[model samples]
Target: MTAIRTLLVANRGEIARRVFRTASAMGIRTVAVHSDPDAHAPHVLDADRAVSLGGSTPAESYLDAAKILDAARRAGADAVHPGYGFLAENAGFAAACAAAGLVFVGPSPESIAAMGRKDRAKEIARKAGVPVLPDAPVTGDDPDGWAVAGADVGFPLLVKATAGGGGKGMRLVTGPDGLAEAITGARREAAGAFGDAAVFLERHLGFARHVEVQVFGDVHGGAVHLGERECSVQRRHQKVLEESPSPAVTPELRERMGATAVALVRELGYVGAGTVEFLLDEDGDFFFLEMNTRLQVEHPVTEEVYGLDLVRMQLRVAAGEPLGLDRAPEPRGHAIEVRLYAEDPANGYLPAPGPLHHYAHPTHPGVRFEDGVAAPGEVSPFYDPMLAKVVAHAPTRAEAAAMLAGALDATEVHGPVTNRAMLAALLRDPDFLAGETRTDFLDRHPVLLAPPPPTPEVVHLGAAVAVTAARRRAADPVTSLAPPGFRLLPGSAPATARWTPIGGEPADVGYRLGAAFGDTALTVTVGGTTTELGLRDLGPDGVRVVHDGVAVPCIVRVHPDGSVWVNDPAAQSGWRPEPRLPDPELSAAAAGPVAEVPGTVAAVLVAAGDQVTAGQKLVVLEAMKMEHPATAAADGVVAAVHVEPGQYVEAHTVLVTLTTGPTA
Candidate 1:
């Protein structure tokens, strides 16, 4: 009840670091609780004191409520702030924190448990006079339920997990025939994701915009909405881009939504920062979705627009202070935020979890970074693949979007293939620029996901450069024969040997050295659409090859096997240029380990000494809360099985090694 002197940030990634920053600024001590793998995470460095929670995985670390409370107690923290995800909305965790006499910087336990179930929240929404979509009757035992509006309404419908936020228990059912599969699938996934398979169906509002009102409540009985954020731009039900004051939300609609949000908070007696989410359909009709009983990931956009720090508000509310205002404050300028993930967008958005090689963020006024971790290596795979959240604010939405685009271009991340280019493309897209976005924005639009093709000029220039390099190779002073030519006379013009560009290829011009053109007999090879080599200056001993008027440094070396090693001359001073050679082992293609997505490991069958058939299941990796088996690459004996039961391995982590069978 007294001033929150020390708060234990029981979270990770950008959110933890974000909360720690606010706590430090408020002259409050912060305790960062981390797992073994996250000992080196940025939040640990930013906190006043740090505590080791436990193992690497979520259940072993952040999800362990008892352990987190103990860590808070050990760190001398008087309060526990569950940032957004993990156990943030867990009613049991909240109750436990209250029982431990530590401030839980969120809603009351009852509100959490009420909204914790999809069916219960729907009933509550219906009673609150909020438009609630009709669904199947709720059963005591949480089974993944199913509901549908009609096939005529849409091509796809959403089946959501009842217990928690995330794409874990969510699935898009394409047709009515797929409802059963989708239900069972959603149930299985929800079980793994939230320890409950209970799910409910909503008429899939495909073109719906996710506009949520940020409602804050203090224990002293004050609650209000801080406006809305557009979180519709997402992939696989995961939000990527969010902005405040959704383009579609009018002042009237905002008031209605805000009033509805406050009504729900009052009905449930909810406390702290919570988001009442609604689906603003294409017809401008908004439907009550659900309530998140914690601070949101995209809260910064709201903070920027509303000109109030939600985290600081949470800290103040936890310390038993009022909202400090009688009502929701007027919102300010526009703000946009993009969640930069550590994944390869081109390769089906595969998680590229590894060392961050080069990380640089552009320093500018309007742009702000709520980053948790950094470069120089080791972005742990045993966690969310989100790298950072970059935000930009401006007087106008268009300017904010422009600032975001420029920031993305200026910032360089060489560690992994990120969605940086795709995000930039989305920000500039005419549809997005017009503010017509939907939940299916990413799914329906393939153009935003694809990298922009190279311009025609660049293509032509690259081809020309390659051809020029080829001619330079043939015209070098160390060169010998020009297509093994025979010279007739010394005074006569050297017999010009003609080379063909071939079909669709650049022109290859071959000519012996003229007396004035060069000092040594030169043979110029041309390929592609342009001349390969432009004879710049040829001296008695050395000749400088010029391509595109740029002095390029090229190194030539002969290996022991007489293979040529060509290297770029302008390699960085401290680093030696690596010799490029064909990796003999990588020449042939083969199916490697099974990709580990966001799922559970249902079973791991083969042991280290087990012989397996080509189609046999070696390991099962469950994701989105479903199980998938990783079969053998070919008929072979398991030389080494790297994973065991319940061991979560990432995609391409070499789960098992195989040796050829006896048939060989």
Candidate 2:
């Protein structure tokens, strides 16, 4: 059998780190390829050696097949492991590796090319006796013609990109009126994400469970299915959470689906790790959705239950080792995995890429935190915003869910806005707890998407307490005496500080030491309310605040921008000291049309002197692989266009100026 002594990982972030862990355990040397922004990335430090790809975007770095092949050759890697995303499913890249005399740890190039096209894969599945969806025949690229074809397929249909997965280039058309626009947008997104603009229409099931079977094939043609993962909890057609041994799937159904997945892979002569996705209707009938010819992001959930390392298995199978499994192993426990992203769920799930000043994971039994970024790292806009995957395992599904929810609640992430709170809320959602999750879970439960913002008073109190704690630590006797304005003097007026919470007015905070709790207690006044809090310093950045006899652990960090960030179990707040100038320039932009998220201007629908009605679509901004249409707030004449198509814009940047029209 051929042996892989050294392996080159042709991916970035968590997936790269994942492969390196497996390679190190097997006594194999690991090499990593990184872009300029990722030079200090966690994965780069974890590798034996690293090559510089020297580009910020994926196109110039990770997706550059030539650069990757060259790096592998330079590192003298015997095999190339594409750890999902980037070039993982790229047939051309796999073929290039084979030409370079390097083993590719994935399916054959021929198999990838066959399954890459959704329309062609459906035909193959049908021929293989697998139940397939009745999709509309792909017409030309014209939107008008596609709209007509979509009518025949009926309303409530899905426009899916043929070349890629991960919710990119996929749109749901609820009616005929939106069919053309949906098709056009889908094509643009698909082309940008996958380099393929071709799309097809499929019937959208109103109520369905998104289930996929994990299958592995060896070069010797031996294949088996390792059960199913229920990925019904989704937002914007992207899976947010995945669990193994779906609560809905019975033993008989699992066998039927597993057998079909294995038979299809064997017929296609596939090898390595792959996932066969299906949609289970309300009546329990299942239909083939598509096949991913590479490792899936949710593979860890399967690994946890099956007690197998899928990545290690990939390496062994690529080295010409047979799976040697006569039958699939039964899963012993339920595992749930949640994708942690640098996104703001309250704001249309817009990506929030920024610094991660204070990042900490929960440590507990049956919990696994697989992350890519360490604290003091920046989440760049050049790649996907997913920071990590938190997985939890337990003997029962309820226990697993409860354990994951608590872990998420206790986890701390500062700097960039994240979906941690929303994820925690979803885990504790009544419908979710009842196992009634579906593809439209988020759509049905809008409240879960945007949890109520922390009250102004709560945020103000948290920030003030955090700042007070920092001052107390800095004034420790061993370091130095308390600074001016902070030193407590007998009969002296209380020390006062002015701070503002995000989106809130400035709050006046006054604090003085209280005799009841000695020097550790502070009588703090926020806004106009006064309260006594018992504080214990837990080192430099941590404090235990006793409020109403309940001890609450809080971590605080001072950001480079002079903002104090407070993270507690119940709330998180970023407080900034009142500015002297009040930033009048920024205030002027707030009166006009501004980008809601940082993104590139894809289309500018209005120009100077154009008259528009209220709610008219003005510009289309693309961010995090999704397009956001910015519209007019009132009927007005466009006075100026501040941004042009193809220009990058930041959040709150004015994109257009308008002069409101006189009311009729």
Candidate 3:
């Protein structure tokens, strides 16, 4: 076996950090490649050596095979770990590494090419005696041909991009009339995401459970399976939560599925880490979906149960060592993992990228936090909105679910909007608790999507306490020149503050300072109720406000418009202080439609002087690998277009103006 002395991770974020941790433990020097925006990223700082890929976008940096190879050569790296996504499953990248005499820590280029396309992979599985769902032949650019093929595949089918995975380039067509549009949209998404627009039709199983078997193979011809992970909890066909030891999978079925995965790996002569995905129906019959010829994003749940580091196994296998496993070990316990993303669940789950001012993770037994960005860092609009993955393990499925739920409840992310509350609610959902999760879980239970907002009293009180504390600090004469041991004396006079919640009426708060609890301790009265509040300064821009023994950590930023943006675990709200002055420009622009999330304008459907109807699509913005259409508010003439195609805009930026002519 050839030993790899130095390895270069050809990706970024948590996956890169994960590979580096394993490589360092194995006494291998690790190299990191980063883009311009990720110059100070945690993964770069953790590596022994780092090289700049230069550009910010994926094509210019992570996905550029030439640049990655150059970085590897400069760092003297003997091997490259793709670490999933970007170029992880790219056959050309694997071939390039092989040609450069550098070990690619994955299956061979031939295996990747064989399994990269869903249509081809299904054919391979069918040939190997694995059951596969009936699928239409790959469609060409002709729209009529696509329509005909889709009809034969049947209605309620899925238009799937052959070249890539993830929900991108995938569309669910319930009828024949929508086939052409679905095909076009799928192709556009596929071409943008994977550089390929080839698509095919597949029989869509509306309520099937998404289960996949994790398989490992070595160059020595040894292969094994690490059981299965249930990934039925999804949104927009993308997995949100994953768990190992699926409730639907029994010992007999697990063995059968495991055997099937191993057989396919052996047939393909695959090496290194790979995942064999399958769709399990209610009758317990499973059909092969496709094989992901690389590590999965949800691999942690499998690793947690098996008590093994899959990355370490990948390294050993890439070095040409045997798996050393005659039979797969039985998973000891249960594990659950949820992806934490910077998206607003209340607003159609739109991507919400901003600075993470007060990021805190839960510290509990059997809890793991794999994060990409540290607090005080910006979640850039250029990449996926996923910030971290939180996983929990326990001796039982119920316990694991509860533990993960609690971990999410305790975790505080106070900057951009996140799906923390929604994920926690899903874990506690009755159907989820009963293991009735399916691919349409979210669609069936829309209530779990938008979590209830915090109590009005909590918001008002929290804001009052925060504002009062800030004012108190500023009012003190010694605040700017205080000594290390200096403490502010309690004041007798009550402090009064008035502020209006974003969508609520103005509130008047009266509070008096008491003994210090770091910053200020006060009893605030609002809306005929008084509650004790303890405010502690976390940093220049953050505070920990405690009420009734529960702490609410928040980051409070005051904009130039005299508005306070309070980001807290309870919720996010903007408060305007008393005597709120309106800007005429902003007030006039408010009549038009504004973007709900930060993204680049993909298309401006309406130009100045165009007549539009209410709810008509006016602009399409792309963010976080999804497109959001901003529609006109009322029937009117387009007075102006604020943003053009390819222009990046922030959340709530007005993109179009309209003249309603006597009505709006």
Per-candidate Cα RMSD to the true structure, in Å, reads 9.0, 3.2, 4.8
Candidate 3, superposed: residue stretches over 4 Å from native? 137-142, 453-460, 463-467, 470-474, 478-592, 606-610, 639-647, 650-654, 661-664
Q: 422-489, model 1: which lDDT tens digit per residue?
A: 88778888889898788888777787776552222222222223333335556776653442123325
Clashing pairs in 2: none
Per TM-score, the best of the predicted structures is 2
State each model's CA lDDT, in order: 0.70, 0.83, 0.83
Clashes of 3: 0
TM-scores vs. true structure, each candidate: 0.76, 0.91, 0.87
Higher-scoring candidate on TM-score, 1 or 3: 3
Candidate 1 ranges beyond 4 A from true positions: 137-155, 453-593, 596-600, 603-645, 650-664
Q: Estimate the lDDT of model 1.
A: 0.70
Tens digit per residue, CA lDDT, model 2, 1-664: 7899999999989999999999999999999999999999999999999999998777779889999999998999989998887788789989999999999999999999998788889989999988876688656767677777887888799989888889988999899888887787888887777777888999898799999999999878799999999999998899999999898999999999999999998999899899999999878899999999999999999999999999989999999999988677878989999999988786778888877887887689999998989988999877888999999999998899889988887777777778887888888888988889889889899998767643334533643555555565577775345432244567878767777764347778777753344425667787688877766653457666677776666677777766677777665666676535544655675435788777788789888888888888899887767788888888888888999987888777888888887424
- TM-score, prediction 3: 0.87
Better of 1 and 3 by lDDT: 3
Selected candidate, larger TM-score, 2 vs 3: 2
Ranking by TM-score: 2, 3, 1
